[model samples]
Target: MTTPADVHGVREPGLPGRLLTVERDALVPLLRGRAEEDFTLPVAACPGWSVRDVLAHCSSAFTRVLEGRFEQGVFSPACNDRDIAERAEWSNQRVVDELERGMTEAGPVIAKAGGVLDILALGEWVHAGDVREAFGEPGAYAGAGLPSALSLMAYVTCRKGHLSLHADLDDADEPLRLGDISGRRPPARYIGDGPTLVRLYAGRPVDGASYELAGAEAGELNIFDE
Candidate 1:
């Protein structure tokens, strides 16, 4: 449980840089203060995973990227679960150390991935929120990462779904289009904040009234579920 006062030094450029900086400056500090028992608390947003398990998963993902091992699917629950299982023997501090190292080492690799980095950032921010939620803390739904994370999420989810839909994020200035770009037209649109959209994508329950769905069925195009 130590502050990363020396975490900032060489900065990677672009969104990857921002994401890593946020992870180091914001997310890392949050975890540093927690007691050992806190890590065992269940994260409501991520079923079957404890707070430590979520960090282990995130650490493993970053480490894999640093090792140039990338998952093929949009979401790999099995792979993620396996990662957490494999690291089960490690102390909580060891997991955090790995995360910090991986973030530093994987920056160049993430930068080279182009648009794929957005999906990665989305995963990171969402998991950070999961940790916060598990500890009964308010999440950074409106944080610096939200706009880019939501945009990347929208792009990936849109690409995966068969239906075309438009999304207007209240916190964002632009509208997000989902589904096939070549399709004749979209049948529905979504109007919501970044938090609602992220929660829905993560398969967490959201207040029904938080967002609006028009002209199509909602919850049909979850990127995380795929």
Candidate 2:
């Protein structure tokens, strides 16, 4: 794995920018390294996939994006078993090699496209958060990447048929308030602890891990992928 840059890549649009580079250099290696493990540990949020499975899925996702194989808006069934299994035979180096080549190849193609920068920006930011969340590092994306990641995730999840939820949170433990606005309110008001909240919305139960949803009812909202 290449050494991480002192400052993560340029958070710009299109390819060859700082953000994508940081994503390639820092995030991919972290993900690939973990993929080589047995992950006997439980990834409660993912239901079935072990840590390795999540990595494999992510690798395929990056591959798709880099190969110009994406749908217009958002995907209904966000991901399926096919994505998970594709990486099953992959080693860390293999995944990294594929990602490096894909991103490099897609660089020019993205540069010529309209609003491609936004796409690249949003993709890396969101996936970075995904790897962070899957590994239980909820605060990993707590930098300049947070706002874009949160906004894009909320928008995409909504587009994919999930409710536009913004949970009210305060200093209290086990707090679970669902809405779209960010600020003070009734039962509680959410602090800007974004990544974990995003995970909760994605149907990944961060409860007792990164968050606590007091009195939260199951299926209160359909938090599944479209």
Top candidate when judged by lDDT against the true structure:
1
* TM agreement with the true structure for every prediction: 0.80, 0.53
- Whole-model lDDT, candidate 1? 0.69
RMSD of each: 7.0, 8.3
* Candidate 1, position 50, lDDT: 93
Give me the displacement of residue 84 in model 1, in angstroms: 1.7
For model 1 the local lDDT of residue 181 reads 60
Worst 10 residues of 2 by lDDT: 1-10
lDDT of 1 at 219: 65
lDDT of 2 at 55: 51
In the range 73-158, model 2's lDDT, one tens digit per residue, is: 32223453766665667665775666666544555555555433344445545545555666776365554444434444433433
For residue 1, give model 2's deviation from the true position in Å. Answer: 27
Whole-model Cα lDDT of every candidate shown, in order: 0.69, 0.48
lDDT of 1 by residue, 3-55 (tens): 11221122223556566666667777778889999999998878888999989
